[model samples]
Target: MAGEMAAGLAEEGGSKIKMIVSYVDNLPNGSEEGLFYALDLGGTNFRVLRVQLAGKEKRVVKRESREVSIPPHLMSSNSSELFGFIASALTKFVADEGHNALFNDRQRELGFTFSFPVRQTSITSGTLIKWTKAFSIDDAVGEDVVAELQTAMEKQGLDMRVSALINDTVGTLAAGSYYDEDVVVGVILGTGSNAAYLEKASAIPKLEGDIPKSGKMIFEKLISGMYLGEIVRRVLLKITLQSSIFGNIDKTKLRTHFILRTPDISAMHHDGTPDLRIVAEKLADNLKITDTSLETRKMVVEICDIVTRRSARLAAAGIVGILRKIGRGNPGDKHKSVVAIDGGLYEHYTEFRQCLESTLTELLGEEASKSVTVKLTNDGSGLGAALIAAAHSQY
Candidate 1:
């Protein structure tokens, strides 16, 4: 069903035949030398990396990573402050290392994974559409983010270039496509949810003014980790009102934060439709005492299972929607489709992965299921950004 949904989405977009290509598949095969930098800004934290690509033989070519926590104030702060912090972090990263010949002359070139809805002007520039992931920054939408980062970097004497700006989904697609010709879509089922697929430039009606010769369109932030929290919040309001623990309990004081969504999912698993006493015990772990000597093991198992199932089924529905959109799952086509799956959810949760695949199979049919394989593509954001950096470089 997921495949059909994606295909349907493509058909709606006026695609004659849905063909989702991953950009990573297009990576140049050669022994090339280039210094690349990738900055990943997502929920909770941000990471900046400098990668040395030795092309095919050496691959990764070497990498360095640094993590910085996003300040609580920044989520609600003005753009200047937010960009300033990012600029300061990047400046610190550069100053941590001395002159390196490969990227010294062009220390200005870098790739940024903004992980939010931005009206991209090109591969290198975009405007912030709005803040998601519980972020409510005013006057942020329509602001040029790349320019903001650039101006801030200069103020800090940081000699770096934001040559490419991509969404995490696009990065995943790029990274997956680099290794597998069959990988067509990149999905992040982390704190939130989103998907990215390679689309033909000719198919985008929204961008009627200009057409790139490469014929590529990348959709980011439209669906990603930042919004899942909101989705959870919406679902919980309905569930709790109908369930036991919250049916009569006043929830007016419960802060509706993005983090609460995780617990909400856990709550739904424990009590959405009753028979949740055991699971509820787990959810109330802080409220109760779990005797390790007893059935504590069983409670944990049940809690994990139910929550994973709930998350997976909803995720499957989203995938199914996209598949139906693309015309890939319809009995009318025979081409195999591959989804490049990433993120903490699919990575850490075994039951969740199983449930997701099961739901997709139930929606798409056995034949299509055989043709559709959801494969994990790890750390695609970091690697894929580097790939984008390489592609945009003159070398």
Candidate 2:
């Protein structure tokens, strides 16, 4: 068996397995201070926060929130439109809370928490390689996200500096580390999902550098909230064709749309059987057309169940992979392998969460599993952003 991952998150004693390591970890050190703001732009909504920092002693003494819905057209709309909307909303937040000393006598600084994947170059700079999770902002791909936000802020006439452009996972790690130095990894299981962990530079085969104690790593966002509905869609189309669900339907119209969100998946999971296809048809019926055929519903539910099942399993695998990469495996290692989990899918999807934890247990056995703790830490993105603002606060 491969080396036990995350103490008990991976299997042990199966057979000897070969492993190769790659990727660099650049997790930031958790010491600094300043009042700061954080803006989270993820699916459906954008959240803005104003946090007052009190440093390590008083830490994140103040916080506020506002949610902005993306107009239906903007989701499938252009990049300029997407970022522009975010810019405008941020402008409004800044203007509404005018003249806060969070700026520390200079322009205000912020930590932008983005959930999408990026090829990060620095804490504050990264190139958006591609947009997934239902985002098709083609123009924004290959551009520096921090710079984009900077440009947008300038356009909005908001005097702000982006000190950090972090993915939600990194923010979670930072948040975790800020509280407990032992927290090495952070995982988000909301509608969509991803993970981040502290890594040693020497452990990374892909990069050449001395391992910085402050450096850590973030994982891929292959399976997260934004992508689950699409996953269900891909699996359901085949079932729909054979099951007569769309026999009376317009394929052309059905061909172009998003039918499910993570909430639907959560609902199906609670339905006992957790059938995906049934959930899909149920979802389609709710959003698209009238329902009749039993076979159609069955086909949809079963397909949905299968896709959801597979996604959970794969997510566990990715976690296994990360824990392995971080040297957290090995039975009875006794290390406190804390995986701080957040997000909608993991939090709301009971069956999915069970399956993931079950898979991890199977992979990592009793003794090692004892050392592994999976915890639900809600909305660290906002609080963590506040924490960063506090840590970097100049006031």
Candidate 3:
């Protein structure tokens, strides 16, 4: 995977991994002050947050946020409709905050955390490369996402400036760097997996124009929360057809794509009951499979374990690949490398998290592993965007 990242960075076409430039030349130094806003549009839901910073001493003074679910139809809708809905939600969120003396005096600055692949042209502007996850807006492709949001905000009569444009991984890295200087990489193992790591400007050959002082590269991976359950479902379907462990049950739900989710498998994998009640219940509830014997329940658990373990180990290898690319994976190198991780799979799924951490340590060996740490930054994507906005505020 690391080799693929290098190829993607060097090659313009036909590369699996896209080491796209983020144009985020600098990370937060913890000196950012004043009120800032963050708009996070990742998947099915988008979030709006307002955070007040008091520099290095006070950190985040006050923060409030709201999550709004996007209508299913809007995922594939035109850019105007989708962004307009987002703008309206953002307007309402700002209105709900009421009149704030701190915000009323100045033009509000916002960081847009767009968790899609984008070709960033500047710190505050980027063109959408392609939409991932559930989003497939045709017109939005190659469009300046920041500009779209800016126009939408204007149409809604909201006075806000988009100070920064970033993806979730970059936001995580920024948020992590604000607290820990050792954090060099940010990995998101959520609904979709991706990573961002700082790199020397000269290291990226495919990068065009005048390179900044530094650059961050984005790496998208296939192993993530969004596909884990689907993988398990396919395996179960295969076994059910061949072995019929599920008995003579309707396999309609099992055949349905994404009918079984990561949370369901996580619950089944963590079943500790002597009879594996949770596994049976999940199979019954999600797939309508019931009256499973102890052996069958154990098989289901094993399948979940297999899928989760594979996903975790693969993610670990990817992280190590990043470390190697940056020369931090050398045996004698004692430099501490902290990877700040966000996303539901890394946060909520205990088995996946443990497997990922342990696999990382295993791949790095005992000596090099001692200098590595994986820290979870909860809601770091949104908060980190706000921090970046503060760092680049117009005021």
Candidate 4:
């Protein structure tokens, strides 16, 4: 699957999938020093962060952050309602910072991490192509998200300017790049999967002249959290129907879409007891099936492993493809390479992380694999946004 996805990305307009070109020309060079704000609107939550940078020697000096949950209705409501709530929350956050000694009179600059499908027109503007992860705001589609956010900020009387509009994956890369120049790719494995990597401007035939500085390409969708559980559920559903393992059980939960979440599957996969007690308990609790035989228990465990392993292996393949695209596939290419990865699944799930690492070693072989590393970065949507804002700040 990773190989297939890579094949699509290698061509203009793509053969199998269309990869979006983010017109973000610049990446952080660890020299940007300022107080910047970051607004990250992800699938289920929005996070805000403020960072005070002390330039190359000191890096990030001080930081403060807050996370707020979006009410369910706002996800499907009007764009104004959604952005308004976000702006209101941001206003309070900014007000609290007013007392901080680190703050200055310079006009504030922000980096907005909008994790959705967007047709980017520039560093600070992009048209929403569509919503994903169950978001369905009708008016947001085709609208410039940066503009939407800026308008909301204005309504709240927030005197701040958006300096950069970034994808989460791109933010991850920026965050990683701020610390390490070798970091070449950024991937997100939670809720939804996607990747961003620096690509040569000449390689993207679909992108015309006036390309941005960082010449990068980001895959909007791939082996991510939102679809992994569904994939596992479909496989489990087929097996349950065919084998009748539960013997006329309710199976209603199994039938429901996304009833089996990625974290649930990851938890089951990590169970290591003799009889896999945790798996049995979770199956009973989540699926309402109990008193399973050893064979049934084993089957359940195997299913979890299978689903997780496939996702991890496929993720490894995607990483390999990116490395190869950039000529890092050679055994003697000694430049230490790093792929900065972020997301709850990649961070928390040990089995998944180990499997991904082992698969990369297998794919790249010993000599070549030594140079490539998958380094986990924290808070891509928050700290990363602040970093980009600092790098692109007008002040």
Instruction: Give the candidate number with the greatest TM-score.
Output: 4
lDDT of 3 at 44: 99
C-alpha TM-score for every candidate = 0.70, 0.70, 0.88, 0.89
Ranking of predictions according to lDDT: 3, 4, 2, 1
What lDDT tens digits, residue by residue, belong to model 4 across residues 1-395? 44554544455534444456776667898998878999998678889998889889999888998999999999999999999999999999998886553456788889999877677878899888889787899999989999999999999999989999988888898999999999999888777677788877766655653222222223322266766667677877787889877788888988888777777777777777888898888878877878888788888778878877777888898888878878885699879999999988898888889999999999999999999989999778888888888877776
- In Å, residue 63's CA in model 1 sits off its true spot by 1.6
Compose the digit string of candidate 3's lDDT tens values, residues 1-395: 66777777775652556577887887888888777899998889999999988888988888999999999999998999999999999898888665552645788889999877677778988888778789989999989999999999999999989999988888998999889989999988998788899999887887784322212222222378977888899999999999867789998998999999989889999898999999988888889988999999898899999989998998999999999988886678878888999999999999999999999989999888888889998776799899888877777
Question: Which numbered prediction scores highest in lDDT against the true structure?
Answer: 3
Of candidates 4 and 1, the better by lDDT: 4
- C-alpha lDDT of all candidate models, in order: 0.64, 0.64, 0.85, 0.81
Worst 10 residues of 1 by lDDT: 211-220
Name model 2 segments beyond 4 Å from true: 1-33, 43-45, 69-92, 95-107, 115-119, 128-143, 151-159, 208-257, 260-262, 272-304, 386-395
Model 2 Cα lDDT, one tens digit per residue, 345-372: 8887777788888878877776677777
Instruction: Name the better of 3 and 4 by lDDT.
Output: 3
User: What are the C-alpha RMSDs, in order, of all predicted structures?
Assistant: 7.0, 7.4, 4.0, 3.9
lDDT winner between candidates 1 and 3:
3
Angstrom error of the Cα, residue 31, model 2: value is: 6.1
